[model samples]
Target: MRAHYRGWEEGDGPLLAAVTVLGRTGPQVHFDGIPLIGRPVTAVETDITRHVTDNNLGLRFASRGDLGLYGLGVWVRSARVGDTSVSEARIGAEEWEEE
Candidate 1:
């Protein structure tokens, strides 16, 4: 799925925003997409560690994954868009690397 979020904040020359994505599955899945704040979206595929029981999937920045409590996944990325930011996230059950 492609997800996008937009909002503006006042007061600052440099724009900043944070984006998070989560996914869980029993089989191999790829959490890929461009989490950005501008046009010409770039696709970024995240390497997800597949869990055994319940297939818990988790993602974090510079942190140990598989820390989610309920099979929930979390990935945080920042976009320097100057106050307003948008995200284009896509999730699929197929291998995105092969595509």
Candidate 2:
């Protein structure tokens, strides 16, 4: 896992983010203690809804990945899963190789 602040807009200042290219999976992300999931990663979302609304309003997600617990006992429905996908995060840096 890695963090990358993919730049910002004119007034956006410094950015913050991460990226990890898995063996078979594409990119895996990680955060400090936990990430910020607004809503929930559910099968009920449509292409019209953006990630911001679904991954920043609930129990959020767990920085724990791969074998880590994915908000198992959490209340938020958006972060009750564990897999290799573009999960949302809030603060902190990611854990991964330098190159």
Which one is best on TM-score?
1
Error of 2 at 47 (Å): 39
In candidate 1, which residue ranges exceed 4 Å CA deviation? 1-54, 63-76, 88-99
**What's the lDDT for all of these models?**
0.29, 0.32
Backbone clash pairs for candidate 1 read 15-82, 15-83
Q: What would the per-residue lDDT of candidate 1 be over residues 22-42, giving only the tens digit for each residue?
A: 222112223333222222222
My TM-score estimates for the predictions, one after another, are 0.20, 0.19
User: Where does the lowest 10-residue lDDT sum fall in candidate 2?
Assistant: 68-77
How many steric clashes between backbone atoms does each model show?
Answer: 2, 17
Q: In candidate 2, which residue ranges exceed 4 Å CA deviation?
A: 1-10, 25-99
Model 2, range 1-99, lDDT digits (tens) per residue?
334565566998766644333323323332322332332334213211243345653233344422212232221112323453233322334332122
Error of 2 at 65 (Å): 5.4
